[model samples]
Target: MTEVTEAGVSKAGVDEAKAAMREIFPETPLQMNEHLSRRYGADIWLKREDLSPVRSYKIRGAFNFFRKAIAAGAKDRTFVCASAGNHAQGFAFVCRHFEVPGVVFMPVTTPQQKIDKTRMFGGKFITIRLIGDIFDQCYAAARKHVEETGGMMVPPFDDRDIIEGQATVAAEIVDQLPEGVIPDLVILPVGGGGLSSGTTGYLKDVVAPENFIFTEPEGAPSLKKSLLAGEPITLAKLDNFVDGAAVARIGDLNFAALKTFSADQVMLMPENAICVTITEMLNVEGVVLEPAGALSITVLEALGREKLAGKTVVCVVSGGNFDFERLPDVKERAMRYAGVKKYFILRLPQRPGALRDFLNLLGPDDDIARFEYLKKSARNFGSILIGIETANPENFAGLVERFETAGLGYEDITENEILANLVI
Candidate 1:
C-alpha cells in the first residue's frame, strides 16, 4: 500500500468522504459549550462525536472502509475486526448497515455491557467470538482467522482509507462553524492516532497546522513519546483506564501523517485529572463522557486561561460509551484529584475513648466515607482504613495538626497507588 501523505488527505477526498457519510448519519453537532467557554474565557465549541450513532467517530472510519472496499470490487465480502471497545461497536453497526457478514473478536474478559451492545448493533449481520484474555492475543487470533479464511480485516487504524474516512470529521467541523469565523485552536484526543491524524491533516489544508493540539493519556503517551523519539515507540505498559485512547503505539499510517509535528504539540493528560473533567461534565453540563472522550476538555486546564482567552477553540469530544458501573470509581478518582477526598491508615489505640477522640478531630465539614478495621485483634492498637471527604483541602491539614497534637498515629495513603489499590 502507498504511504498516506499530507497531500493524500485532500479537500476533495474529505469532501467525498463527508458526502458518502451523509448517507449513513447526519453530521454530529458542533455546539458552543457555554460552561466551558465561560470557564476558559474563550469561545469553546465541542464537536460532539459522542453523539454519533455508535457514540463515537469510529463509525465514520468503519463505514468508509466498507464502502470503499465494496466499491473497489473486492471479492471478499466477509469482514473481520478485533476490538473490545467502540471500534467493535462501530464496525458491527457498519456491517449491519452494509448488509455484509462480519466476524468480531473480543477478549474473553471483555465486559458484558460492551459485548451486548456490539451484538445489539450488528444484529444478524455479525458473529462475535470471545477469544483471548488480552487485546493483543485477541488481535492475533483475528489476524489468523482472516489469513485462513481469506476475509478482509478492518483494522482499528493504520489504513489510508480509514484515515480518509476519519478526516470527514474535520470537514464537518469546518462546514458547521459560523461563516467567516475560524477556530484559533482545535484540540484532538489521540489513541491509535486515527482521529488526530485525520482531523489534523484536513485542518492543516484549510487552516494553519499551528492551530492544532493533540492530547493523549499520560499513562499511554504513544503519540507524544513517538514524536519525541522521532519514531514510533511501543510502550511497555499502559493504564487502560482510558480504554478508548490508551494506545501502546501510534498507527504507522497515522504517524506518517503526523511525523513532522513537534512533541510540544501533544499534551499528556493524567487519568485522574480526566476523571475530574468527566465528573464535572456529568454534573455541570449533564454530559456523560468516557475517559477518552474527556481528554480534549481536560487538557484545557493545561492550556491555561491566559493563553486561551478570547480564542476560538474546538474540542472534539471523542466517545461516550461509558459504563455507568465505573461511576463510583470515576467519582473516587475525581475527588482525590480535586483534593477534597483522601484515604488514610490510622493506628487507633484499643480503647473506648480513642475512636471518639479521632472523631472529634474532624472539622465540621469533614465526613468519614469509609471505615474498616484491618487488624482488630491487636492487643495495643488496631489498623483502621479510613476514607475522609471534606469541603476544602485545608481541612485535611487541620485534621492532621489535630492528630499530631493528640499524638494519634496515622499515615496518609491517598496518593500511594500501590497501597490504595491493595486496600482502598
Candidate 2:
C-alpha cells in the first residue's frame, strides 16, 4: 500500500473512526499551554489524550476496534487480550461498552492495583486470568486461548486495526488547532510506534512529517535502535519504569508505517529525567503525569531555545495512569536527575565527634535526608551512608570542596544503579 493510504486508513477513515467513538466519549482537549509556551518561547499546545474516559488514548483504539469488529458482525465472538496496564483497562472498558464477553490475561507478577482496575473497568463484561510469571508467557497463553476458542485477540499496538484506531488522534489534533495556526513541530512519544505511525499516516496531507520528533525512554530505545540499524530490532534489556512506552521491540505493521522516517527524528529521553518532568509537572502545574505521559513535554528541553524559538509546537500527552503510591520513588529519581540530591559513602574517621564535624560542613540549604552507619570497616575508619539534598545543583561543588578541605574521604553513589536500587 502507498504511504498515503496508511494500509487503507485514509484521513476520512480516521475521521470516521472519531465519529464512531462519540457514542462512548467526547473528543479530548487540545489546550494551548501558557506555562510551557512561555518557558520555551514557543506557542505550545498540548494534545491531552490523558483526559480520555480511561485516562489515556488507549481507549480510543480499543473503542474503534470494537466498533469495527461489531460492525462486521463479530459481536457474538468472545474477545481477549493480554496486558497488565493501560491496554487492559482500555480493552475492558470497550468490552463493557459493547456488552461483549471478554477475557484479560495478565502475569502473576502484575501489580494488584492494575488487576483490580482492569476488573473494575470490565465489570461483569470480562474475566481476569493470572497466568505465567512474565508478560511474554502470559501473552503466549492469551494467544493459545484465542486459538483454542476462536476468540478475537485485541493486540496492544501491532495490528492495522489498532493503528487505524490510533490515527483518530491526529484527526482530532487537526480539528483542534487554532485558526490559521500551523504546527511547526509535533512531538510524539513512541513505544511500539502505534501512536506515532497512526498519527504520521493521518497527517501526511495536513503537515510535513519532517517536522515530527519522536521520543522513547533511553533504557528502552527500541525504535531508535531499530531505526539506526535500518530495521526493527529487539532491545537487549528493557526498563519497565516508563511502562506505557517501554517496549522491547516495535510492532511489525507500526514499524512498516514509520520506516521511511530518518533515524535522527527519534530522540531518547533518560528515564530519570522523565521522572524529573513528572515531579515538576505535579508540583508546579498541579498536573499529574506518568513518565511516558511526560515524554513529549520533557524532550522540549533537549530541543532547547534555538529550535523552538518563535515556533508553534504540539505535544501529545499520551497517558496519566500514575499511581500516587510511587510518588516517593518518583521524587527520588527526579531529585537525582536534577542534581539536587546525592547519595554517598563517606569514609569517616571513627571518632565520637566525626558526625558533628560532617554536619557542620553542610550549608544551611543542605539537609541530610538519609544517614546510616553502614559498617566499621577499620579501627580508624567507618563507612557511613549519606543522602544529602541541596537547594541548588551547584551546591554539590561547594560540598565536595568542603569535604576535600576537611580531608574527608567520600564516594558518591547517587548514580550507582546497583547500590542505589538496593539501598535507596
Candidate 3:
C-alpha cells in the first residue's frame, strides 16, 4: 500500500485537503439552531454538510481521493466506484471537476432521483452502470470491472485515502466553530463508516470518543454488529429506504479506524423514527432531509433532553437528496411512528346499521384514511381493511376498547410487518 503521507492523508494532510476543496466549493455552514436548542434544552448546532455541491459531504472524500491520486502521478487514471446514492453524486461531481473519465456502479434499487442527479453532475465525464439489487452486489460488480479494465478503484468508504479525505469534514467543523465553543457531543450517521471513522480519527485528540454517538439505521446495524464481533461483519439483510447510509457491511478500513470505540457507542435508529424526523424537519423547519440524513437528528429524542441538557451538541445533517415523490410514503411512516395513524382489520357486520355502528364507534378526532373489503373469508365475514388517522394517538386505544367491549372482533394490522407490507 502506498503510504497515506505520500497520498496526503495525515492530520495536516486533512487540513490541506480542506484548503484544496475551496477550488470546488467553500466551507459548508456550521449554524447554531435555536429551534432544536430550545426543544432539547441544549445548545445544538448543525454541520450543514447537506448544503455542499452534491448536497453531501461525500464530495470532500471524492475530491481528495482524486486530488491525491492524480497528484501522486495517476493523472491519466480511469476511476470507478460503487454507491447507492450520495457517494455516486460526489464521485460524479469530482470526476466532472477534474475532467477525468470515470464510471459509477449503482444498485438497480437506487432511487431514480439520485441516478438522475449523478448524471447531471458528471455530465459527459462519467458513465453509470446499474449493476445489482444492493450496494454490496453493486460493489462486487464495480470491483470486477476495475480488475478487468485495469482502472483505479475509488472506493466509497474503504480506503486510507478515502478516510483522509473524509477527515477534512472534521477539520472544517473544528475551524468553523465559534470562539471558545467546544462541542460536548457530536452525533454522526454511519453507513459504511467512512464519515464517522474519518471524523473520529481526526478529532481523536480534541473530542473524547465517549462524547461521540455513532448512529446506524436500525434495520442495518453493521457498525454495531462489527464492533461486537471485533471485526467487520456483513449483514444478511438490509433495508435500503435509508439509501445513503444503508450498507450491508461496514468497510474493513473504516471499521479498523473505528474499532477503538465500544459497541455501546453505536446507536441503531429505527427507519420509521428517522421518517418522523424527516417529516418534522420538513413541516416545522422547512428543512428537507432524506432518511439517512435524518439519522443523527432522530437519535436526539432517544438521548432525551435530560442527556442533552446544557451540553453543546453538533448533528451532521449529512445529505438532502430526498425525492419529493417519496414524501407521501415518508409521511405515512412518520405518522405511524408518531402513533397518529394505524391500520386494522375490523369485523364489520354486514347488516344495514352494522357499518353505521362501527362508524359511530370512532371518536370525533378520528378520520378514515382507507376503508376496503378484502373478500369474504367466511360466511358473512369479510376482512375490512381499515386505515385510521386521528389527531391524537390515544384515540385509537378508546376505539379498540370500544370494539372489544361491544364483542366486535378485530385485528390491529399496524404492527404486523407482513400484513402491513402486503395489504396496507
Question: Which candidate leads the pack in lDDT?
Answer: 1
RMSD of 2: 1.4
State residue 423's C-alpha deviation in candidate 1, in Å: 0.7
Q: Residues 1-424, candidate 1: write the lDDT tens digits.
A: 4334473566677788899898889999999999988988999999999999999999999998999899997535789999999999999999999888999999999999999999999999999999999999999999999999999999998888888889888989999999989999999999998888888888885668878899999999999999989999999999999999998999988998899888999999989999999999999999999999999999899888999999999999999999999999999999999999999999999988989989999999999999999986478999999999999988889999999999988999999999999998
**Number of backbone collisions per candidate:** 0, 0, 0
lDDT of 2 by residue, 1-424 (tens): 4345554567677788899888899999999888888888999998988898888899988888888899999989999999998999999999999999999999999989889999999999999999999899999999999999999999999887788888888889988997888899999999888899999888887778799999999989998888888888998799999999989999988888888888899989998889988988888888888789999999998998788989999899999999889999899898999999999899999889988999999998999999898888898999999999999999999999999999999999899999888877
Q: Given candidate 2, what's the lDDT at residue 389?
A: 97
Displacement of residue 253 (Cα, Å) in model 3 is 1.5
TM-score of 2: 0.98
Candidate 3 lDDT, 1-424, residue by residue in tens: 5224322356877888889999999999988888899999998999888899989889988998999899898778789998868888999999999999999999898778788999999999999999888666898999999999889999888887788888888888899888888889989999988888888877777788799999999889999999999999999988888988988899887887888888998999888999999998988889988788899999899999999999999899889989899999999999999999999887766667888888888899999999998877677766799999999989988999999888887999898999899998
Clashing pairs in 3: none
Of candidates 3 and 1, the better by lDDT = 1
Q: For model 3, where is the 10-residue window of minimal lDDT?
A: 1-10
RMSD per candidate (Å) reads 1.9, 1.4, 2.4
